[model samples]
Target: MSRKPMLPDGLSSYLAERWRGIGLSLVIVVATIWLGVTGQLGLYIHPRYFIFTTVMAVLGLVFVVSSFVYRTPSSGEPVSARRRAVALSGSALLLVIAAVTVLALPPATLTSATATQREVNSGGLDGAAAAEDAAALVGTGDYERLSVKEWVSLLAQSDDPALYADKTANVTGFVLPDAADPDNVFYVARFVVTCCAVDAQPIGVPVYQPGWKATYDTDDWVQVTGTFVSNPSARSADALAVLPTTVEPVDQPSDPYVY
Candidate 1:
C-alpha cells in the first residue's frame, strides 16, 4: 500500500506553520533594501543614519535566512485553527499596512506649511550650548558658508548684530514668509534633521528685500547672497537681516538639510 507523505519535522515545519511571519520578515528586508537603494530613505531620515540602519537590516535578513536553513523540528503539535487565524491576521495586517504606506504614498520633502506648524528654530533650542558650538566652528574660517543653524545660533548667543554686519551670507534654502509681516520679509530656511523627518526643525535667516513677496512665493528654493545688517527686527539676535544682493532660483540640493 502507498504511504502518505509526512510533514517535514523541525524548523521547516515550524516556518511553514508560521509562514506569515517569515513572509513579513522578508517583506521588511526587501522594503529596507529598496529604500536604501532607491535613495528615497533620505526623504524620511538623515543620511548619516542610513549606513547603520542598512547594516542592521542586512543582519536581520541574515538571521531570517539562517533560521530557514537550520530547519529545527517543532516538538509540539500544530497550533489550533483559531490561534492560527489570530496569528495570521495580526501579521498580515502589519505587512499590508507597511506595504501600502510605502507603495501608495509618494515620498516628499516637508514644505513651508509644515514649517509654520512646527517650531521654527531661528536661534535653535540648544540655547547657549549651540551658540558656543557655532562660535567654535566660525573660527574654522569661511564665514560666507555659515549654515542656517550656525547663523541662527550665533544670533541667539550674541545680542550684537554689528559683529555680523560686514559678513556676506551665501546660503541655499526654501522661502517662508514671515507671517506677521509677509510683504517685506521672508526667511530662507532649511530643516535640521538629527535622525528622521519626524524630528526635523526649521532653521532660517531672515531676508528683508522690498517686493520679496511679489518676487517669490513660499517654498521656492533659492540661492541667497546678501550682506548682513544687524537688525533686531530680523529673525534672531545673531541673525543679521540679509539684504539679498542676489536671490536666484536654484534646484533643490540632493542633500537639503544642514546635516
Candidate 2:
C-alpha cells in the first residue's frame, strides 16, 4: 500500500487538534518578538520583563520552527466523523481569533479612557513618600520641574495652598477630567504603572480651568505652566490647583507612563 499523507481525511483532525496549541504559541511568539523589536512591548508589559519576555519568545519560536521540521507521525486511530469535524473547526476558530487579536492589533499605550474609568489617584499611591520625594524640590524653587505624580503626592499630603503658592508648575500629561467637577476641573495627568500597564494608577495635578472643555477634549496632551493656587471652581473638591498661565496642546510624549 502506498504511504498515506500525514493529513489523510480522518487523521487531518488529529493534526489540527495537536497543532492548535502550537499555532496559538506561534502567534504569541511572533507578536512578542515584533513588539519587542519595534520598542512597543512597553505598551503592555513592564520594562523589567522586556528582556525575559523577548528571550523566552525566541526560545518558543525555535521550538515551533523545529517542530515543523520534525513532525510526529499522526495516529491513524479512527475518529467519529462528528468529533473529527468539531476538532478541526475548533482549532481553526481559536487560531484565527488568536492571530487576529494579538498579531493584527497595533500596540498602543493605555489611554485617558482607562484613566477616567479607573478613577485617577484611586490606586493606593503613598502620599507621605511622595511628599518626601518632593521635599528637595521645594527649597530649590524650581517648582516648574515638578512632575504630575510628585505634585499629586505633595498636594495630597498638604493641599495647603500656601505650600504650592507662587510655585509654577510646568508639567505635561494627557488630560483627564475630574469626574465630580468636569467642566471646571481637569487633570494634567500621567498613568503611574507599578509593574505593568494593567496596574496603572492615574495621578494628576488638577488644573482649575473653567470652560476648558470648550477648548480641549479629554486625552488631549497639554503643557500647563502656572502657579498652584486655591481652586477657583465651587464644584471642585481640590483645595490647591494649577491655574495655568499657558495651556498649549502638545504631542503625546514618546513614553506616556510613569513607571
Candidate 3:
C-alpha cells in the first residue's frame, strides 16, 4: 500500500517559524490600519504620531505580502520530532493570543479606575512644555477655555485661592475621587497621554462638593463650571478646589484624552 509523503521535521519547523512570523505581522498591521481608518488610533497613541504609525503599518504590510510572495526553501537538516511538535504548538498558541488581543478586542481609553492607580498630576505637567502652554493661556485671560492639562500645570505652580478665585473654570473630564477625602473632594480629570496609552498620566483640578457621589459616580463625564476656593475638606491635599456652581453630565468627547 502507498502512503502520502509528509514534510521532514526540519522543513516542518521552518514552515512553522514562517507562519508564526507572518501571523504576528498580520495581526499588528491589521490592528494599526483598522484603528487608523476608524479614527480610534488615538485611544492607544498620541494624535501627533497617528500618521507616522499608519505609514509604518502600511510598510510592514507591504513587507509581509512580499514575504508571502517570495517563497523560501527550507534547510533539510534533521530535527527531533518531540522538539518540532512543541515548537509548532507554541507558535500556534502565540499567534492565537496576538490575534485575539490586537484584533478581536474593542478599543478603549484609560478610565478613572486607571487614573486612581496613579497619583493625580503626578508628573509630565509641571514641566516646561505645560508651563509654557499655561503661560500662553494665562496671558490670553481665557481661563474658562483652559484644559485639564493647563489647569493642572497652573495648580502645580501655585494653588493660592487668590490667584484663581476670580478666574472661572469651565472644564470637562471624567470624575475621579480624591484619595484623601472621597466624600467631599473629587477631581475633574483627563489622562494626559505622553508617548502612548501605557505612559498616560492623570491630571486634574480638584472639586469640593459634599454628596457628589450621590449625583455623579466615578468615571462619569461632566462639565464643571465653577470658581476656585480654599478646600473645605481638611483631609484633601489640594490647597484650592473648584466650588462648582454647576456640574452637568456630558458625553465623552471624541478625543477624551489630552496630548
Models 1 onward score TM values of 0.71, 0.87, 0.88
Tens-digit lDDT string for candidate 2 (25-89): 88999998999999888777768889999999999999998886777766766675567667878
TM-score of candidate 2 versus the correct structure, residues matched by position: 0.87
lDDT of each: 0.74, 0.82, 0.88
Arrange candidates, best TM-score first: 3, 2, 1
Candidate 3 local lDDT, 1-259, one digit each (tens): 9653377655676766588888789889988999999999999998989999999999999999888788787766666666677777888999999989888888877998788789987875547888899889889899888888888888888878789868999999999999999999999999988789998989888999999999999999999999999999999989999999999999999899897
Which segments of candidate 1 are over 4 A away from where they belong? 1-24, 63-100, 103-106, 122-141, 230-239
Lowest lDDT 10-residue stretch of candidate 1: 4-13
Off by over 4 Å in 2: 1-6, 9-11, 69-77, 80-86, 124-129
Please give the distance, in angstroms, between residue 75's alpha carbon in candidate 1 and its true position after superposition. Answer: 14
lDDT of 1 by residue, 52-157 (tens): 8888889989988776677565668866544555665677787788777766566679899889987666322476666777777678767776777777777666
Among these predictions, the greatest lDDT belongs to: 3
Question: In candidate 2, which residue pairs clash?
Answer: none
Residue 113 error, candidate 3, Å: 2.9
State residue 178's C-alpha deviation in candidate 1, in Å.
1.9
The pairs that clash in candidate 3 are none
Better of 2 and 3 by TM-score: 3
